[model samples]
Target chain A: MIEVSGLTKRYGPATAVDDLSFQVRPGLVTGFLGPNGAGKTTTLRLILGLEPPSAGRALVHGRPYPELRDPLLRVGALLDAGAVQGDRSARDHLRWLAASNGIGPRRVAEVLELSGLTGVARRRVGRFSLGMRQRLGIAAALLGDPEVLVFDEPVNGLDPEGVRWIRDLLRARATEGRTVLVSSHLISEMALTADHLIVVARGRLLADTPLAGLTARFPTLEDAYLSLTSGHVDYRGVA
Target chain B: MRRALAAEWIKLRSVRSTYWTLAGVPAAVVIAALLALHASSLYDGASAEAKANAVVSPLETVAAMIAQLCLAVLGVRSITAEHATGMLRTTFTAMPRRGAVLAAKAVLIGATGLVAGLATLFPAYFLSRWIAGDRPLVFNESTLSQDLPSLLAGASLVALFALVGLGLGAVLRNAATALGAIFALWYVLPMIALNLPAPWGPRLGAVMLANLAFQLSGDPPYPGALMLSPWIAAAAMFLYGAAALTAAALALTRRAP
Candidate 1:
């Protein structure tokens, strides 16, 4: 389980995440919803201890992420697919990460097969297309088979088939009693995949409710989200 | 920490650059040693002073100087390449203890540098000795003993330069910029030190890496050169490497990903 309480992050005079509080329960796909610059990524970074929170705290399994004995076994995350050495083959890239967590080569091969990357596992990441890179990232996130998984924009560059594959994967992961938190701008995709929603705008929590409850007040989840975040968007284009 | 070390080792060896750099060290050493040996042979008809200068010193010194630059680039690339490719995020994410990660990188790279240094320096020394056969320099028990320390010093110098590169790479976080900084410090600054007036010129040259390596290896200091004793020079080079790594660790820990 993931618990975030009164979490806040401020950069100079700009507040990125303000008094954010939420709980992500196991066996559910929790959608972290926010408009552009709405602090979703910042909140994820804070949870992972990539950056210290200005106030409050984020805990994974009731302790800070950095305090975990074996962090990879508890929480697996893919914040950026491009955050890998391009010259390393997919197999080598995963091998090193696995080594760090004391994970063996068997699981490395298993994940490659599971992600449908076995064919290209030996190819350099520099030569991979964006879709192939996403699969590699997903393969890495599954390297340890943690109880909790976090992915930011996992389906951004995937083809239609790949998109469907991830949607099924997320649902299957949640069914197996894992806590999955996915952040995305695809409201339609989230509606189909997420069970719970945590919406934010301008770094403030606007709504935290079940998907059904959030969609009950409007015709669709997007309609309700637009209504709640209409005035909170950080940028406005010229009329 | 063991796991972190293992992971770092894999990361170090998995890249093509690592192989290129490791291979380049011996290639550079062999080529430089051959050239230096050729140059030494041409001193057959020179003055007694010139022959003395050529016979007493091993060609490994010149080869080591060239090899040190390659090892330094290897060291710098080890860390800077990670930063360049954003692999640092994945690395730090897996092992959140920032200092431990940096330490693992230092240990792995330093060890590789040491091994490469020894592998290249020994052969170069023996080859140079063979090439200088029949020269007035006698290979007595005392001279062989002296040669051993010099060989060790040359190897240690390679490792030290690698550590320096690692530290600078971590602090700078960019391959090109870090390489430039290291080049300036290793080559340019020493050149500038040569032209400076007294006391200061020797003082600066004394601490410069190349000069320190020379002194540590028991080579006669250049004219007007001021350098510490062998042990002190080794210690000083170690200190510089330590200082660079410490600064790198601080920068990594204090900065957000």
Candidate 2:
């Protein structure tokens, strides 16, 4: 379980995440939906303890993230797929991360196979294509086989097949009773994968409802999201 | 802590730059040896009267400074490279205790420095001794036993550079800025110290890293310069590393990634 309460972040004079409170329970795919500049990434950073919160606190499994023992074994995250050391091979990259959390090299090989990266595991990350990088990122997130998984914009550079792979992966992880939080601005993508929807706009919570609950009242999830976040869109192209 | 250490060990070896930096130690010794050969040639060419006045400073001494620079670069690359590549976020996410992670990195970086120091300084000692070939160089007058203390102190200084570079890297978070400060300290500041007015010149010079090994080993860099007692010089060396590390620790733990 992940709980965020009264969480706020301010950079200088501008507030990024403001007085937000929410809970992500286990056994479901919780889509963290927001438009651009909606503070989705900042909130995730706070929850991961990458940034100290300005106002409140975030709890994972009833304790703060930093306070947890073997954090990677409990919480796995893929914040940015391209944030790897390009000089390292994909296998070596995972091996170090595993070593950090006391996981064995066998798990590194396992994730490489699971992500279908065993063929290119010996290649340097700098030479990987975007799709390959995404796969490597996913492999890292699953390195520990944690109960809580967080993915930020995981499908941004994927092809149709890659997108389908992500959708199914998230669903499968959630089915195993793990808590999954995936953030994206694409409503259509969330419609296929998210069991619960937590929508926000302008750094404020707009809706925290189940997928079935919101879909029943609107023609589509996109209409429901647009109507709810009308003034909060910040920028839009002309029709 | 052990896990972090193990992980960092893997990190330290996997990067190609680490090997490149270690490779520099032998390469630096070779360069210094070539310079020594040139000095040896000059000494032989001079007339009998002029030969007595000519001096060749130990080759190991010259090479030690270069080795320190290489290790400092190694230290900076260990951390700042992660910052540049954005791998620090992933590291922190996996192990959120920023202090612990920083400590782990410092431990490995310092170890690399020690190994690098031993590798370069030891070989240069024998090579310089061999190259001088009874030419009666300034350092050649002393036997290996008499020079071991200074040589060990020199190796310690190299490790100190690694820590200094690492601390600056964390506090500065940019390789260019950290490396610039390191260069200024290692290369530029000692020259500026010598040009300063009396008392202060030798005083500052005495504390400068270039002079510490000599002073700590009971042989000041030069005559008439302030020569701190061996223990005091060692203490000063310790303080340099401690100050840099403390500053880096605070910088790393107090701020956001």
Q: Tell me the alpha-carbon RMSD of every candidate.
A: 2.2, 1.3
- Candidate 2 residue pairs that clash: none
TM-score of each: 0.95, 0.98
In candidate 1 the C-alpha lDDT for residue A159 amounts to 96
Model 1 compared with the native: what TM-score? 0.95
- For model 1, residues A65-135, the per-residue Cα lDDT tens digits are 98987688888898889888898999999999999999999999999999899999999999999999999
Clashing pairs for predicted structure model 1, backbone only: none
Q: Which one wins on TM-score?
A: 2
| Cα misplacement distance, residue A111 of candidate 1 (Å) | 0.4
Query: How do the residues A136-209 of candidate 2 rate in per-residue lDDT, one tens digit apiece?
Result: 99999999899999999899788898899899999999999999999998899999999999988777888899
- Give the per-residue lDDT digits (tens) of candidate 1, residues B165-250: 99999889888898898888878999999988987988898989877877887665576688589889979987898899999999
Residue-level lDDT tens digits of model 2 in B128-237: 77887888767678888998998899998999999999999998999999999999989788888888899788888988977888898987676677888999999999
Candidate 1 chain A TM is 0.98
Candidate 2 docking DockQ: 0.86
